[model samples]
Target: MRSSPRLFQYACRITLFTRQNCSLCVNAKQVLSTVWDKHPFVYKEIDVMTPDAKGWQDLYEFDVPVIHIAKTEHGLERPELSAKAQKLMHRFSAEQVMEKMDIISDPKS
Candidate 1:
């Protein structure tokens, strides 16, 4: 079966869910700050303490450095990012990033 190239080409949207006073979250923020500037994509952090951020508390109380991708349709529950999210951040888009890295893909396989 032939697959649509556009679907394969879709860039992943990463939404970093975090809270105050979390060491991991702090570290994640620092890494994102340094790298995202080059990628040219927005990374937002939501504090679980805020009233508006209540919805995040259940899933993130123990896991403070949860990263949610917008691709999930049924909210930010399942399919949460793994520990390797740090490494994956480097896979950001080169077309928009300051330092461009050639991304090669084979459609015919």
Candidate 2:
């Protein structure tokens, strides 16, 4: 009997919006680091205070240190985030990140 081929799934990338001198951002990074130890997802940090990030700063002024899971695609330098992916606050716990990862990873979600 022939066995079916195994399928491999690509890991999702996460974006962290942060700013300098922000205690919340610091705490969020720590939490994310802890979660990443187990979940293992690529993450990028965006400094909203930077001049190049004007748009991001305006949009997330009150929501600093936002965490967003990037949308997956076959080829793209920076994949767009899915509409279903909700922006998480900096206060989110490791467990919450895990739950979000599960939701984002689910094909049906």
Candidate 3:
């Protein structure tokens, strides 16, 4: 008997730590959406004010728009980021976010 081959898809989860009435958070979401148009991935928005994000408020209070990209594979999560990307996480532009996404998604990099 012959068996068919199964194909696996590569996906990453992008979490945006944001707060209500935050201008930076809005800008971040807009940038992320632009990036998503080219390289799509699972996107999640987390509000620091909620109970679910209790501890995060302390860490990301001032950093209203933080992005975390983690790969999902075989039920395991792994972060994919370069040193430059990490530095850009704090304060970055749409172009910078796209650049980071390209770096993380590129298999050869």
Candidate 4:
């Protein structure tokens, strides 16, 4: 039987805000690719340079690969993915990084 994604161990949504031909953004995407391949999560790339994306300019103008996570009302006491991933892998063999990605992509929030 197929299980609901919401019931998974952990789920993270990684969103990358970048511009065209930005070297740092390229590197960040590469890193995220590796991370995705190693985990069970979803990722999205956004070009804030686009006119329609101006709304995000104020918060992440300089931070191209800004990451955010969803919380369980507690507001994510500590939203450090790398550290949390490491700890999880140490305890379980599955060690799915994607399952732990608690990111938000919509700039409206």
* The candidate that achieves the highest lDDT relative to the unseen native structure: 2
> What is the TM-score (0 to 1) of candidate 1?
0.50
- Candidate 2, 4: how far from true, in Å? 16
Reference-based TM-score, model 4: 0.55
lDDT of 3: 0.63
Ten residues in sequence with the least summed lDDT for candidate 1? 100-109
Candidates' lDDT values, in order?
Answer: 0.47, 0.72, 0.63, 0.48
Model 2 weakest 10-residue run by lDDT: 74-83
* Residue-wise C-alpha lDDT for candidate 4, range 36-72, written one tens digit per residue: 6765455556676777667656555676654433432
TM-score of each: 0.50, 0.78, 0.69, 0.55
Clashing pairs in 2: none
Local accuracy of candidate 3 as per-residue lDDT tens digits, 20-86: 9998787788888887887676777778788866676766778778886654442422223222223
Model 1 residue 108 CA deviation in Å: 13
Candidate 2 Cα misplacement greater than 4 A, ranges: 1-10, 74-84
- Higher-lDDT candidate of 3 and 4: 3
Candidate 2 structure lDDT = 0.72
- TM-score of model 2 relative to the true fold? 0.78
